[model samples]
Target: MRDCNIIKDLLPLYKEDLLSNESKTFVEEHLKTCPECENLLNEEIEIESKNTKPLDFVERRIKKETRYFTLAVLALIGSILIFIISYLNTPRHIEYDKDLYKVYRNDKIYTVEFADKVSGIDYTDTEDAIYLDAYSTKYDEIFNKRRLRKSLTFRKENLKTVLYQNHESMPNMVIGSGEIHQTLLPRLFLGFYARLSIIGFIGLTLILFLIEKFRKKAISLPIKTLLIGAPLSLFLGIIAIKGFNTATYYPVTDFKYIVLLSLGIYLFFIFISIFKEQKRM
Candidate 1:
C-alpha cells in the first residue's frame, strides 16, 4: 500500500511525461499490477482526448490566434513606449551657449533659463557642485522647437560650482566655479541597480533550479514554473529598458519602461502557462 501511494503520488508527473526514465519505468511496472490506478489514468486520458477533438481544435485555434494577436499587440505597444520614454529620458548638452542660457539669483534661489522645446531636464547635484542638462526627444527637437522661456531653480544651500557638462565627453563649462568641496555621481540614474536586479534574480533562480534538480524535494511544481517564467520576464523587462547599458540619466523614466515591458511579459506568460501542465503538490 505504501508503494502504491508513492506511485500514485507520482502519477501526475508520469502523465505529463515529466518523470526521469528510471521513474517512468518504475511507474509503468506498477501500473501493470495496479488495475485501479491504471483505470484512473485511462479515464483521464480519455477525457483529455475528448478535449482535443475537432471541435476542441477549433476552439484551440481561436485561442491560439487570440494569444498571438494579444502578444503581438503587447510587444508593439511595449516597444513604442520604451522608445518614447527613453527619448524623453535622455539628456542633450545645452552646450553652454552664452546667449541661450542665463543664470540669476534672487534671495538665494538660483534659476537657469531653457528653451520651451526642452520637455524635460536632468541634473547632477554634489555637496558643492551642480550639473544641468536639457531633455527632449530628437523628434521633439526637430518639430517642436518653439523657444519659449523656461527656468529651473536651485536652493541656496544646494548651489555651488555650477557646470553644464557636455555628457561624459568634453570639459564642463563653469557657470559658477565656486570653491570646490566634493564630487559625486548623478543622484538620478539607472547606474548599477538595474544590472544588479537582473543578475540577482537570475542567479537566485539558477540556485533554486539546481537545488531542485539535485536535492530531490526542495520546491514544488508551482515554484519551479515561476522560477522559469517570472525571472525571465523580469530580465526581459530590465533589458527592454536598459538593454545591457550600465546607466541612464533618468532612473524614474527608465522605471516606467520596466513596468510597461513587464506588463507585456506578464501577458505573454499568462498564455504560455496553458502549455505547462501543473502537477499536484
Candidate 2:
C-alpha cells in the first residue's frame, strides 16, 4: 500500500495508543512530513471535538432564562390570586333600596351614605348631573366592612343633580331638581366592544392562516400572534366580566378586570415554559 494509505490505516490505532511504538513512530513521522495527512488528522480532531461536547442550542437558551424561573413562577401564582380576589371583590348591580342608602343635603352640598350590605358604588357624570349605581358581591355583602359608613360627598354647585340609577333604565330615583336628563345605557358601548373583539379575533385568525397557506412571503409571527391574542383576550375578558345577555352598569371597571386577567394568563405560560426547560435539564 502507499505510505499515506498505510499511515491512514494506522491513524485510529495511533490515536488510542494501541499501535506498537515502532508503528506509532512511523505514522508520526509521516504526519510530520505529509501536509495532506497532517490536514486530515486535524480535521478528524475537530470533528471529534464537535461530536463530544454539548451541542444543544436550546440548552444555551435555557441557561439564559434559568435565573428568571423562580420569578416567573411567583408572578404566575400571584396573578392567579389577584384574578380570584378581583372577582370576589367585584360588585355587580344591585336593586335600589332607600334603606340601603340615604341622600341628604348639608351646607347646600349633598351626601349619600351606604349601609354595610351595599359594598360598592359606580357612577357617571354628565353636564350638570350625576348618574349613580350601587353594587355588591356575595363576599362584600356578607363579610366586607367597606360599605359601612361609606359616604360620597358631591359638590352641589355646578353639578347639582344626583340620580340613583338602581338598574338599567327608568323609574330610577332623582335627588335634586326633577329635570329629566336622558340616561344612556352603558351596555351599548361595552357590548359593542365585546362583539367587535370576538369578530376581529376570528378575522385575524383567518388572515394568519391564509398568509401561511399560499404566500411566498412569510407572515411575521409576533405581529400576527399579538393581533390574534389581543382581541381573543378582550373577548374572553368581557365575557368574564359581564355576561353578553345584558349590559353591565360599570363599563370601565369591566375593562380593567379583563386586562388584569390576561396578564396573569401570560405569566402562567412563562412559568410553565421555564418549568419544562428545567425538567429537560
Backbone clash count, each prediction separately: 0, 0
lDDT of 1 by residue, 141-244 (tens): 76657756667777777456776655454435445664434333433345455555567677878898789789887674435545565656666776665667
Model 2 lDDT per residue over 123-191, tens place: 787775677777778676666655456678877666656777756456355576565656645566767
The RMSD of every model to the true structure, in order and in angstroms, is: 16.9, 7.5
The collision pairs in model 2 are none
Which candidate gets the maximum TM-score versus the true structure? 2
Query: Where's the lowest-lDDT run of ten residues in candidate 1?
Result: 272-281
The TM-score measured for candidate 1 stands at 0.48
Give the Cα-based TM-score of candidate 2 against the true structure. 0.60
TM-score to true structure, per model: 0.48, 0.60
What lDDT is obtained when candidate 2 is compared to the true structure? 0.71
10 residues in a row with least lDDT, candidate 2: 218-227
